[model samples]
Structures are given as structure tokens and as C-alpha cells.
Target: MTSTQRPRAFRIPAADQTGAIEGDVAPPSTVRMVEEPFEIVEAADGTPVPVAPKSRAPWLSLLLVALGGLVSLGIGLSLERMISDLFAAAPWLGRVALVLLGLAAVALAAIVVRELAGIWRERRIELLRARAVEAMATRDHTGAQAVVRDLAALYAGRAALAGGTKRLDTLGDAILDVDDRLAIAEHELLSPLDRQARNAVATAAKQVSAVTALSPRAIVDVAFVVFSAVRLLRRIATIYGGRPGFLGFLRLARSAFAHLTVTGGMAVGESMLQQALGLGIAARVSAKLGEGVLNGLMTARFGLAAMAVCRPLPFIREPAPRITDVAGELLKGSGAEKPAP
Candidate 1:
């Protein structure tokens, strides 16, 4: 090398090539650029999207209602003509028939009066429950205690709810504040009573299979199913501190039918549980063993639904009774040995 050689120019090495020490060199970026998943584009004013209308089976229902009205009118006319003919032939017999008809009408009116009274009671109880819930939510100890007292009085005859009522009463007398009292009431009183009511419905559903299995005719099966469902709903309602009577049963039946209609005629008969438990109305009409079983299951579902409708108070923490579980237990042919699913 020459004595006076120029100094070599220094150059920095790339990190990738030289493997620069960590924390000494800049690192590659971890960020990525991405397009937005969706874009909102403004649409022209007055433009509308077309959609199919939902059918609630209104037309079919209307048609049936009209047909029923016509039939009822025809029956009334025919009955009137027959009564006139009977009066002309035998005035004494005609008078007796009139008296019997009047008595029957009076009996029907009495039933209507009883139903109205029960409905009034149900509304009052429901209002009480709502007020109690509101009081609990607002942390009003005095109001909540008053509600508890009223509920206890309403449930005086319910032996199963005695413990819960007593516990609630004790809470009202204790040093616990509103929140504690409400929490304890829900845990110690409402929850247990709810469970007991649900268990009662389940137990009734389980018995449906046993009772229906013994029926010789489809009509008999259907009758037994309906009777069982009415009893079950009443039992469940009573357990939950509600009074379910004849009108209550009718209300529940109407709801069940409406449910069937709204489901687009989807056969409840396909479900094994529906087939074995309740409302076998579908089964009766279908005239199939499988359909009958499905109808039975439907009846159980209706019973559970009726209980919900009849309950004076909303459930605090417990879940509503499941028709599937109750019906499943019945379909398994082990009503006594198995509990609800």
C-alpha cells in the first residue's frame, strides 16, 4: 500500500445482512393495512326494499269463523222450528223443556260470574307481584315487607309455600336492609316456591303418558289428556299462588290453539314428547298413533304454558318448566323411575 493511502470510506451494514444486536437496530413494522369489511353507501331517497308479508293465518281463521257463524245460525233456526212444533204437539212437554233450557242458561251465567271474579282476583295478585318487584328494585324495605305480608296472606292455604312465607316474614322482622331482605326473599322464598311449582307441572306431565296409555279409543285418549292438562294447570297455578278455574282452562286452551295456528301448521305430532303428553287434539284429528303421541306431548307443553300464564308472580330466579324435558321423561316409559330431563 502507498505510504499516503487515502482512508477507506466507512459504510453502515444493513441489519438483515449483519444481524444487528437487539435494541440497537430498528425493527420491521408489525402493522398491516386492511380494507374496511363493509361500506355504507347512501341510497336514493324514496327508494324502498320489497319484502314478503308474514302470514298469521288470518284468512283461514276468518273463513272458519264465518263458517261457524253460519252453522250456529242454522242450528238456532232449526231448534226454533223444532221447539215450535213440539209446543203445538204437547204444550206441557214444551214448557218443561223451556224450564230446563232456562236453568241451563242460569248455570252458564253463574259460571261466567265465577270466572269474572277469579280474573279480578288474578289481576289484583299480579298487581301485587309487580309492586313487590318495583319495591325490591327501588330498595324500599317498608314497601317490600308490606308486599311480603300480602303475598303470605294470599298464600295462606299453600302448605308448600309455608316455609318461604315464614322466612320472608322473619326477614321483615330482622335487622337486614332492603337489599339483603330482597336477596334473601328471592333466594329463600321465591326460588323454592318456583321450583316446587315447576316440579308439580313436571309430575303432572309424567302422569299423562300412564293415563293416556290405558285409553281404548282416540276420543277417550283425547278426553283424558284434556282433563289431565286442566288438572295439571290448576295444580301448578295453585302451587304458584294463582287460582285457575274453568275459564282459566278455556283461556289456556285458546292460547294453545293460537300457538298451533301461528306455527304454520307444522305438525306437533312429529315430536315424540308431543305425541305422548297433551292436547292430542292434533292426534285426534290425524287419527294416527304417532300423531296421538305428539299431541300428548303438545298437551304437556300447553300445560307448562298454562302454568306460566296462570302464575300470579313472575319467577324470581328459577327457570320456567320445560315441556321437552317433561315430555321426554313420559316418552321414555319410565315415568316413576325417571325425573324430568
Candidate 2:
């Protein structure tokens, strides 16, 4: 079937369905959401959304540009006047002034180049992080691993540049330590989890293939899939020392809430696919498929986020059992993913 025909399992529901889905998003149903002390407003769908901290981007940019322009203009004017005066007064002194000016210009240019390089390097690091997350979301372990290696290499370069300062060395060491552990996590955790995810998704796809339209069974299955994914995420997080305490579970719920947009987008795309396919499939069927797939993917994302937020210590030893080993171990006797043969 076309990707569009897939269920939108990840989409967040309406404000009303928020409660039902919230439980499935994270566990410990007793946990209450702690409100952030900030401006709150209603979303388009009438949901109360919190306003995030404002950025001082425009003011900062304007100030920087204005200061740079003024400095450049003043330097140009002063240099021209000084050179003319020096040339008219003493030719030898004028030559010496020109040489000094040239050296100063070279020094300024070097500083500018260094700053630009730093910005470029920072952006490159961010891009690598995005690529790694995308790879994890798509369950591409090899791609994720490659990205982690690149990240580790970048951290190594930073460490080399850190040189002799104790604080810089410590920061560099911490970064390298995290990246190294991440590299190990890729093999020890992500690899097996990916395999299990494929199995889970395939099994889910089969169960929903026969659905011609949304039905009670379809709805129940959708909830089941979501809840299962959430549980798996919690289990994965716990394995890495990120067991969702009341606060942590609340955090997870908020993150999982993002699935609404993901699933909704899938639904929109699925509708378009239905028209294109001209197979007379019911709109509800396509919508259901999209939701399922989206939710499943979101579940994976939640797990990854949970792991990061929990900030568990790095697993330095490869092939050694971490806080827990394998999905089976994390899941205990819950009959999650069966042991790999």
C-alpha cells in the first residue's frame, strides 16, 4: 500500500480526547501536570497552550549590525584622514603608518575569519544532531551510528582545541564521554530496539490491513498501539536510569502530545493519497492507517527523548549489560518484544 494509505496513529487528538490519549502517552496516571509560570493562551482548537520564553533575536541582531556598521564607517573615515595628513607632513612617517594600518587590517580580518569559522562549526554540529535524531525516528541504526561517530569526532576536535585550561579540558572530556557512551548505546540499545520496532510495526500493519473504515476495533487497536508504544518508551527510559517519576512521566506526556500534530499531518496526506489512488477506499480507512503509522513513529521518538531527558550515565562498556539488558530485560515478564532467536 502507498505510504499515504497508512494510518495516522501518531496524530494528537482534539482537546477533549486529550485526557484519554494522555494516559496512553505516559504512565503513572496519578501524575498531575505542573504548570509553567508564564503566559497561557488558547490554541486554534481551543486548547490552552503555554507561551514559551521570548527570544531577544531581533534586538540583538539590530544592535550588532548597527554597532558593526558604525565602527566600520568610523574606521574608514579616520584612516583616510590620518593617511592624507601623514602623507602631506612626512613621507617616511606616512609609509610607516600605511604599514601599521595594513597589519591592523590583517589582524581584524583574521579575527573575523575565526568568528565565522566558529559559527560554521556550531551549525555543522547542530546539523549532525538533527541527522542523528531523524535517523533514530526512522529507525535507521546504521545512519544513527554514523552520525554519532561524526559527533564524537567533532567532540574530539573540540577537545584538542581545548588545550591546557582545566575547565575547558573538563568540559571537553564530559562531551567526549557522552558521545562515546552514545556510540555504545547505538549498538547496545538502539540496534535491538529497532529490530523490535520493525516487528511491532509489521504486526500492527497486518492487523489493520483488513480495515475498510474506522470501526470500534480500529479505534481500540489504535489506542492499544499507542499505549504499547508509550509503555515501551517508559521501559526503555527506565533501563537507562530514566524511570519516569511523577515529574518525569509528566514530561513524557507533554512530549508525546506532539504526536497529535504528527498524526494530523498524516491524515491530511492520507486524504490526498485516497483521491490520487482512485481505489474508492473509504476516507476513514486511509485516516486510520495514517494515525497508526504516525503514532508508532512518535512512540519511537518519545523513547529517544525520554532517554535524553533522563540523562542517564553513559554505558562505556560494549556488550556489557547496562542498567538493564535487551527489551525483554527492560520489560521484565510483561511479554513485550520476545527474546531474539
Q: Which candidate achieves the best lDDT against the true structure? A: 1
lDDT score of residue 95 within candidate 2: 95
| Worst 10 contiguous positions by lDDT, candidate 2 | 322-331
The candidate that achieves the highest TM-score relative to the unseen native structure = 1
Q: How high is each candidate's TM-score?
A: 0.49, 0.31
Decoy 1 TM-score against native: 0.49
For model 2, the stretches where C-alpha displacement exceeds 4 angstroms are 1-64, 152-182, 185-341
Report how far residue 303 has shifted in candidate 1, in Å: 2.5
**lDDT of model 1 at residue 143?**
82
